[model samples]
Structure formats: structure tokens, C-alpha cells
Target: MKEHHLKLNVLENSQAFLIEAVSKAIVAENDARNWQFAILNLVQSLELSLKSILAKKHPLFLYENIDNPKHTVSVTKAIERLENPMIGGVKFSEKEKKGMSSAIKLRNDITHHEFDFSVEYAKAQFLRVFGLIVHMFRHHFDIQITDYIDSNFIESLLEIEKSRVVLIEHANTRMQEEGVDSSLVWECSNCLCDSFVADKSKETCYVCGYQTSVEECGKCEDYFYSHDLRSIEHLFETDFCEGQTIVHNSFGYEPISICSDCYVAVQRDIDEQWQQRIEEDEYYHWSVE
Candidate 1:
């Protein structure tokens, strides 16, 4: 088999293990032990998936010396290297990066110290981890793991969802006690849960801790936000802003209405045109006369 195919098979096996771990964690009576093992397996799955992607690109990335067993890239190192690295047409989001970092930290804590673990926390982490896995499989490998989930597992997932709702309610109560506007809740993009308390002033989501300024897309007139596309003003300042405009909102501030998709399309088109021009030019001039 090709190296990429072998790496993909490894990723698939890791995902299968992750699914089993999650199912046991949710359905089993022992919360502490089950969650402990679940989290360990979760971290393992993430490591294997990341390493597989890196290995597909080049086996050297997974090992410092291909011949030596001792020399290998750590999980932390793999994550750091994958920062902003595009794989299979999908780029890792800042929220996903933060989630991975948080998972790693939690895993380390669980391994070293005797920390209090709750079903709610485990469920939340499961959602985040599972979401990442689904994204990678669907987008990166063009595979679907949904078929792997049996009916019993699906029922357990529903129970977990109910638990998550209760947790969100508790979170809202805590936010209210802390003088935060708990009424301003929004759906979290990361967990796809309606538990994200949006702080418009800070542009932060309290639930997932994601920070992004929401704006209406001028073309679609739909409100959208992106953690990655922060400095979009440069695009408007360039020739790409032929028909795009920044309009003053009711809040007395001008916000651009460029959605992430539109922004990407514009940038991609510009890059392709630039590359074509370079290819056509016999002698490209660097200095302006």
C-alpha cells in the first residue's frame, strides 16, 4: 500500500478506538475511571490522527531519524507544526487549535495529579474531540464515521446532549451571578451548542472561549464571524474592494460585511491571477522605475 493509504488506515483505526472509548465513557456507571480512560484514549486518537497526516506528507515529520525508535515527534510538537498548516483543503481553525491545546493540558493534568473529574466536563470534551474527528474524516479523507455509530451509541449521545443542556443552564446561572449578561447567548460554532454567551463588547464566546467579531456579509446579508479573518481591512484597501464597501452600523461604527467564504474566494482569485501573470512574464521587474 502507498504510505498515504497506510497513514489513513492508522487514522481510521484510531478513530474507531476513540468511538469505543467515548461510548464506554458515556454509558458506563463508573464516571471517574471511565472518563479517565476516555480522555487518555481521546488524546491518543488526536495524536495518531495528527501524526498520520504528518506522516502522509513525509514520514520524517513523525520521526527525527527513520531508523531510530527513540527519535519521534511529540504530540505537542506535532500540534505546533500543524499551526496554520492546510491539509486536504481544510485549514485548522484557531478555535480548533485552542481546543487541542486545552485537551492536551487536561490530559497532562489527569496523568500527573489526582484531579476532580465530572461527567459534564467529559461530555463537553467528547463533543469537541468528536467534532474535530468528524471534520477531519469528512473533509480531509472524504470519509464518514457516522456509519460507525450504532443505535445504542446514538441513544447515549442523546442522553449526553441532555446533560450538556443542564450544564449550559448552570453555566448561565453562574454567568448571571458574576454580573454577565446571560441572556445574550448564541450558538457556539465549535461545539454546535446554543450555550455560547456572546459578549458583544469583547466579541467573545463564554462557552468555548472563542473570540470573533460578528459582521453582516454585504453580499449575503447574513451575519457571520471568523476567528481567523481579523485583518480584513487590507483586502478592502487593495483593488479587491471594487464593489465591496464598509458601512456604518447602528452602533456608530463602520464594519465590513465580507464573509469568510467571500474573503477566501477573493484572495484565491487574486493569487491565481498573480501566479498567471508571473508565468506569462519573461522578465519580472521587482523595482518600480
Candidate 2:
């Protein structure tokens, strides 16, 4: 029981670390992409949670009466085997499993590849997993992680995540050995009808026909495939420059992917709009109109 309590404490602390890590990833500077670091931070949290359940050389999960050793049994051996998918671990129910597993898969998509938020997917996953993690933290630790994590820890994770991007280059070279460029690839949901995957052997989307000539292999980092595009939207969406794109690279993150020229153009327009709005707000105190 003492061991269980201690492990639970560790898990709580890890959860705190995760929530903080994700918050930092949100604001970090890097050239890789946006939202992914946050997504990866969440992934690390789930991995920690999944690994915690198997502390006893246990296959996924097994339970025992701490004092009555005879009560040890495989969790799956029970007809009541719990399945929780949000974290891709077994718990006790199909809903729990599906919710968690799907969240993890979404996190994996943006973390390990280039992806933008799907309003439908991102909001649902975030709300569910955040609730589930918080709930479990309370059940196990009698503490709340949101209060536990501090700004200092978040700042640290931001720095660490930035550093990790360096190692990614090496990881990409490794993928080159596999004849794929790890940079231009990602993993997406099976329901993808708008996009197609070229790396069937790895079952990942190359995601390369437009914004780049490089076909990235999601399974590993390696070489890139050459491609061509006629319109920027075919590869680079209009959103890329019009504040629709997010980028992560060695330099840091850009919330929008605009060329310096276009960025300046938009900034000028934005400045004018802000000034206009300010003047309007000052002079036109609105009545019900």
C-alpha cells in the first residue's frame, strides 16, 4: 500500500509536469511547427500514465491484494477487464478506452507530423483528456495538478523542448537511412479522404505534394521524396500567409507562415485596422443598434 501510494504520488507529479509542459510548448519558439510540441508534451504525459500501470512487470495491468498475495490475478483474466483508450491503456470500460486512445492518436498525429487543428478533434480530445487526467489525479493523489505546476517548470520544459528539436535533425538523418525524410512526414487518422499516404509500408502520410518537394516518412527520419506544385495553395495554403499557418523550425515557432514580405504587408494592414478600431471605439460609444 505504501508503494502504491508512492507510485500514485509520482504519477500526480508527472501529470503536473505534463500540464505545465504543454502550456510551455504552446508558447515556445522553434522552427518545427506549432501545436505539436504541446501535443508531444501531452503524449509524454500519457506515456507516463501508461507505464505507471505496469509497475509490477505486469502485462498492461494486474492487481493484487497487497497483504493477501493469493489474490494476485491478471486484470484481463477478470471478465471485467477495463479498457481506457484516451491513454491507450486498459482500465474498465469501452468509452474510457475509446476516448483516451483516440486522444493519444490525435496527439501522436500533430506531435510526430505536420497537422493543424481539426476543430472537431482537438476540442473534444483536449476537454476529455484534461478532465480524465484531472479526475485521476484527484482520485489517486488527493491533489490537483493545475495548482501543483508552477511557471518555472513550464519555462524549463519550453527550453528543453527547444533543445530537443536539435536532436530531431539527427533523427531525420536516421530516417534517411530508411530512405525517408522524417521531417516531411506524419501519422494521420484512417478517415483521411482529403489526403493520401505514400508510405504504405509504414502506413503513414507523406504529406509532400504541395508545401514542399520533400516526401517525409513518418515511420522514421531519412530521405525525402521530390515533388512539384503549381499553386501555393496546392502545397502552401492561403492560410499559410494569411495567418493560417504555424511553423516550428530550428529558429523557433511562427504562429503564421507568411513570407517576410507578406508578413510586413499584413502587419501594415493590421496596424491600420487597430488604429481605426481605437478611434471608432473612442468616438462611437455604441447603443443598441
Candidate 3:
């Protein structure tokens, strides 16, 4: 049988890390210094929880090099091992993997080097990592994560999550009820959520209250956030590589922002041109024959 006491110890340590993370996170809202440590503790909590899950299979799996067995595995390696068919066979979605990878990188940056993070972005990342641990506790261990942490601290975290969902839902509801055009709704540059409303007079994010003016795509003449447009420019250079001087072309074709539609249209035109050239070459060969 698996070492039941060892599993319990790992889980308790994981909860301790989470509790410490929560205390830091609460202070981090106003105190910038605490954000770094909060994130570190949060990642530590996630790492220990992952290790506990892996420990169920074998204790040696916790080590970075199982053959030598000196140090514990990093979060990334633990995740990779968990997904192995012979080891754990736990399936993680692409989105989950991306979030976890980002959290791990953030943890490494905070631990090894000086770093700065905006509070809003930090909170979003903390929640993402915490959600992963919650999933493991609830699904794998059949225990609610909220039951392990301080009720007051967890309430604040849950409130943040609830508010985020409500903001998106409110924006979507407005879109549907007001008969707003779907094209007018875009991803918010601030929160990276699909809650930005680009009305004619004003453009604003429903979630984060980030406001910016809307601009038309040069080629398509469709409205889009200024940041969303891709600027296309022509350049002239004598030597293409190896430290060559390059200048913007002054052939009266000013740099302009192109939307995705215009980009796709240009690609389609090029494809059609290539097809026409191929057909002409085939016809010439037939005539010569």
C-alpha cells in the first residue's frame, strides 16, 4: 500500500503554504512588496500538491533525477511526469498547461531575480494557479480547498473570482439585450478578456474600465482598437543583413494599420496570382507540344 502518512504530511504542508500565500495576498492589495512573496508561496503550494499526487505512485518520482534521488522535481517536470501514461496519466488541458507554465515562470523570476508586476495582473495569475490546486484537492482528494484555508481569506479570493465572472456576464448580457453588433465586442487590452465594447463615440473595457479610442483599419475601413491593428510599412535597404542601414520607403505609400481581414485578403490575392501564373505556364507548354 502507498505511504498514507507521507501523503497526509505533504498535503498539510501544501495547505500551510497556501495559508501563508493568502495572508500575503491580502496585504499585497495595498502593499507592493508582498506581491512577490505571495506569488512565490502560491507556486510553492501548487508544487507541493502536485508532488503529493505523484507520491501516490512512488516516492522516488518526487526527485528531480529519480536515478540519483537528491532533490525534488520542479513543477514543470512534475506536470510532465503526471501526464505520462505509465506514471500518472493525468490529463491537463492546453489552457491549464499555459497558465501553469506562466505561473511557474513568474515564480522562478521572483525567486531568482528582481521583478515588478502590476497588481491586477498578479492577482489574475495568482487566481489561475490557485484554481489548479483547488481542482486537484476537489477532484483527486475529494476535499474542498476552501475547507483547508481561512474562511475570511478564501472569501475575499472567491469574491474576486465572482466579480470577474459577473463583469463578463454583464457585458455579454448588455450586448445581447441592446442588440449590439457582435463585431463591436472585442478582447480588452487590459484584462485580456472578451469584454471590451467598442461603441462609435467611446471604446472601453467592461471588466477593467480601460478606455481607448477606436480607429478604422486602413484597408478594410472597419473599426478596431488602435492596438489591435497591425502597421504595414515598406523599407529600403542596401545590405539586408549583417548590420546594414535601412530606411523607410518614401514612395508616397504611408504606413497604415491593417486588420486581420485585410491581411487575409492580401494573402488570398497573392495565392490567386500564383495560381494564374501556374495555369499560364501549363497552357504555354501545351501549345508548344
Which candidate leads in TM-score?
A: 3
Model 3, range 9-55, lDDT digits (tens) per residue? 88889989988998888777745577788888989999999999898
Which of 1 and 2 is the better model by TM-score? 1
Per candidate, the number of residue pairs that clash is: 0, 29, 0
- Window of ten residues with lowest summed lDDT in model 3: 232-241
Evaluate model 3: give its TM-score. 0.65
The best-first sequence of candidates by TM-score reads 3, 1, 2
User: What TM-score does each of the candidates earn?
Assistant: 0.55, 0.35, 0.65
**Ten residues in sequence with the least summed lDDT for candidate 2:** 228-237
lDDT of 1 by residue, 67-112 (tens): 7836667887776655635522336788797678778877888899
lDDT value, candidate 1, whole model: 0.65
lDDT, each prediction: 0.65, 0.46, 0.79
Question: What TM-score does structure 2 among the candidates reach?
Answer: 0.35
Candidate achieving higher lDDT, 1 or 3: 3
Angstrom error at residue 51, model 3: 1.3
Output the better candidate (1/3) by TM-score: 3
